[model samples]
Target: MKKTKILILSAMLVSTLFSCQKLVEIKETDLIAGDVALKTITNNEQGIIGAYAAMNVEMGILLNAVFADEVVTADFYNAATVHEWQYTSTDISIRDSYTAFNLYYRIIDRVNRVLAALPTATAANATDEAKRSRLRGEALFLRAFCHFELYRYYSNSAVGTDLAMAYMETPSLQPQARITVAPYFQKLKADLAAAKPLLPTDFSGTNVYRATQAAASALQARTALYLKEWNDAVTFSTEYINAVPLASRANFPGIWTDANSSETAFKLSRTASLGGRIGSLWRATSASASNIGGITWTISQKLWNMYDQANDIRFSSYAKDEPLLVGSGRKYTRLITKYAGTAYGTAAENVADAKVFRTAEMYLIRAEARAENNDLVGAAADLNALRAARINGYTPVVLASKDAAISAIMDERFKELAYEGHRFWDLKRRNLPVVRITADLPQVNAATTLPAGNFRFLLPIPNAEIQANPVIQQNPGYTN
Candidate 1:
């Protein structure tokens, strides 16, 4: 372990330094300091709670908003640099990402602090060994999860190619710290492996809110696929699926709206008026009206028509009719109502706990890995199982070949996991050529296709970080 300095002021220390919103402050006196001022270790339960607290401000909100549909509105061009034609590595999107990144890293730092303090924690009987192990596992899984997501979106990593983005190892307390991509994933993989055995089987015990062993398995499955570990991907995903009670078709959509359902692998359980609400930003509004953040977001027409086919459940899950407000005369396509029944104001009043990892994804991951491994029969069975649960009368798919099985799994992934921030990555992972349909009608507008090497795939490093940290290298094809 590195000997770093630890500063335990009020969390007001962070707010004073960062000028972020008025979030709840973790009491400072409770933290225990070791010899190195750079690190603080605490055996308190609050340390574990603090690890979970890092999810919102640090990463989820910004990543979901930007990656979900992208900033296509005309106003986006003016409000944010990522949308502007003059794209740079040091743009605000990249900069904003630093704060988010720091959030996760901060959690990781705290986890490490707790680990360093573990010897003393154990001696004093301040923590139960089993409970301590479970908490440690949760922290490891979260650290790996956040880093993996950052690698995919920000770093340049092509599907099935060796030229993906570098991964970060330690969360640098300093503003800008550099970590390479390969080593980063290695650390994540190692962390996840360590945590897998220690984590509890029932993470969502009463609230489906925390990470469990199943979540660790699901995450391992995702990371394996990203690293091209096909067999490992299948293994972990299979383990996760085996643990979950498969959902019936009629209960599919409820997985998103009704958090109480068994289908949710892990969720951020935010009761009404409790946590961050994404619905407020996504609710239907007029084209002419400014977006909630002075930037209006609409569902992509191309994404909409993908569901127009018969028996496509996503058509309902991802879309709605746009009246100027809620009930104006003019009609257009609004994003599918993932957050349903709850009004935006009510939803936004409290943060809806973010659903970070779910079981539905493991099924798709298994299907993809099985197809890639030339197990077409196995792949088809998995694909059909997920479909049978969604489509009222889905006919089982018969695969004569691997390619056909792959196609079926991809389609199922599109339907089952659409708008959950997985499609863009799924397409990227498959190395599929993406054609952005920018035409006004959306079904067919501008057929802008980027080859597999298009630089757009690599998110520009947060510009501010690049400027602040000289060691942090800009991803290839983007400017510093």
Candidate 2:
């Protein structure tokens, strides 16, 4: 492992949904030098906790909501860079192109630090040793998870020649070149596989906030689904689904409101004190009956029309429609309520826990994999199972062919996982064009269709990274 000459005053260790928060800080400058910060098992535990806090699933959701078809922005928002798809590799604004390069890499650096320190750290007894094992598992999973996220945006194509992400396992100040996706995924799977046995299966209460065996399986299922590893996708997703079944209709809305952890396999706690609320990512910033105009970025009319607003549980789980007084008449605007702040404490509006891994997604993953593997009946069963769970009176449907099953699964994912950051990637993975309805696009003056294989499909490598690391390669169709 390359030793890093680093200066981290506090947490470089924050993570996202399904991990922890708050890294252990030291009073002195050399917190990371010669294993000063993590010289004990307790220190290692705090370090890993800090790594988990660094991740924010909202990062992906916020970017995709604007760039993808789920949202339509008005001219008033002035988010042309991202909303209008005018982003360059060099545009570094918060609302510009979607790239969490520095953030994810920072997490990888902290996780690597924990891994390096875990070996020599003092363990007083077997209990401490057991804790060490769990810490190691969590650290490995986080490192792989960060790399996977980087690949999700950075890799245009996960091919041998296409530049993917620099799969980091060591901490260093030296610049590194991007590697091919094939090897990157290879190492990603290797890390998950290694950590699987070491992690615990009990993902109850606060345990779900950490990296559990179930969370690792969830990540595996998602990774395989993207890479077209049908059998593995089914295998890993099944593991997660078996551990955490789909939420019942009565419990569905509660998942988003943080009222209950029904089908949630992993979620990051979003304390109001942290001020990490993302409900305002859109124009309205917060959604409600009184603040109808607060629904700034109206939910895409096309996508909204697809939902059974009267019956389907998800229609209400994600958003609501309120009458808007426009001119003398009235018009209704859809408000995204998925991030509706918790009743536990409503001091903050639009603040909700990042439920990263829901069992509902596993069912979809298994369905997609089964369909791709030519198991139409199995795919239909999985699809219908999730539908039955979400909708009031869903009846099973027969898929005539593989294409039909895949199409159904894709649409199901669109509605089931809307605004959770899956829409754009699902379309991209399937090589399908992003087709937004005319009603949603015209109001925002946004493009109706982002053709498949467009350069914008892959976020450009950050210009800062490209400049600092001369060896790093930028994605094609971007400027330095």
Candidate 3:
């Protein structure tokens, strides 16, 4: 089967704010109006693909790593303002936050347009009907997924009962009000529920880039785990695990390079010509001088020490002990190979597919849920299952208590899902502290730790967003 051709609209077209901006302003110079673009099944399909393409950018993935303890600046660049936690609403990083906020909302708008057009979209036959339903399901999934991303970055503590993020169900020029955390999650889960039946059990024609029933289940499992719905997390995660098995130790390394891994539930299909420099941001590459992959950031020694380097396949698969040259020819021996671009079969050094969801995460989710529910034995088994697959000469850990089980699960999650954009959010959702040690590294600050309840963990809402939408209040501890 042919790869799904990326059909993204122009950035200016998709980047328009939902409030006080006419939707008609999204039209291109030669293309038809936005409304006409979604009138047919083919057009709606393109629009849905565009929504997926919106997530294909790099900032969201990189910001998560930057905020976490996984990386430190490589001395070639200064991100100290954001990296050292001295950021506010007006910082340059905040501009990237604004762009991410708008990007996800743009995805929501595109999905909403397709959903609105679906009922009356021109379908030629029963095959077209099937296509329409699948498209609708994918759109709904994208809408939920985008909203969840926004909530993770911009919202206050998930445990708090306050306005968090907006749930955009329809396209409108009216200022969208931020809903409270409870209701926002309600809407998020509803979208996934509605989408589940419409999607196929698995993607057809090798299309794991698109949403499948397994993908929806895995996302719902993640959502439930975040919400502390232990039973629901267990149910959905089990459903996903039953459908997709873990990649074996030998096959696991290939998953990073070979985009189409059996372990991946969903990933954003990226080509050298289409995607952003994701791999470059994390790894050092020889592709281009501009693609000095780890010039801005490299893996932290703290994270590197988490694995038993001799026995853990993840240590070898995700990291490299190559010499990193700094000013005056001073060289360091730690680099993160997780996002290196060599795997994408592209000449661009930093080009690699963005992994969205993997079956490995489902096992971790299930383990956490079971541990929370006091099923230590079951949780340990789940954790051991994942470890056995990723670690060489693995030993099945036996946890005798709930706390032990939870800690093991957390450690496994850190090792298993390190650079794939889960570390920071995992720390936040679990209410764990963000601690950075300056030991063995001069690039980072000396022993800075942000407690679990600190206000900075929730990013400051961009000042531009606050200015544009009066109804949207800034996150506390941030000034407009």
- Backbone clash pairs for candidate 3 read none
lDDT of 1: 0.60
Q: Which predicted model would earn the best lDDT?
A: 2
Give the per-residue Cα lDDT of candidate 2 at 39.
92
Residue-level lDDT tens digits of model 1 in 101-194:
4555566676666665544454234446446666667767777777776676665352333433334444345544445556667777898999
Model 3, span 169-219: residue lDDT tens: 999978777888888898999999999999988653457888999999988
- Candidate 2 lDDT, tens digit per residue, 1-480? 123423232224333322433223324564456467789998989888898898877879977777788886542456666666678877755324366787899999998999999989999889998899899999999988888888887773645566778888889999898888788888989999998888989988999899899999999999988788889999999999888988889988888778898887678888767966767665343244443334357678878888887789999888776445354232345567788774322466667888888998999999999998899989999999998887787778999999889888888988988888888777877888888778776445567788998888788888778878999988889877
CA shift of 436, model 3, Å: 1.6
lDDT of every predicted structure (CA atoms): 0.60, 0.80, 0.78
Off by over 4 Å in 2: 1-34, 94-97, 156-158, 283-293, 323-332, 342-346, 442-445
All candidates: TM-score: 0.78, 0.89, 0.88
Clashes of 2: 18
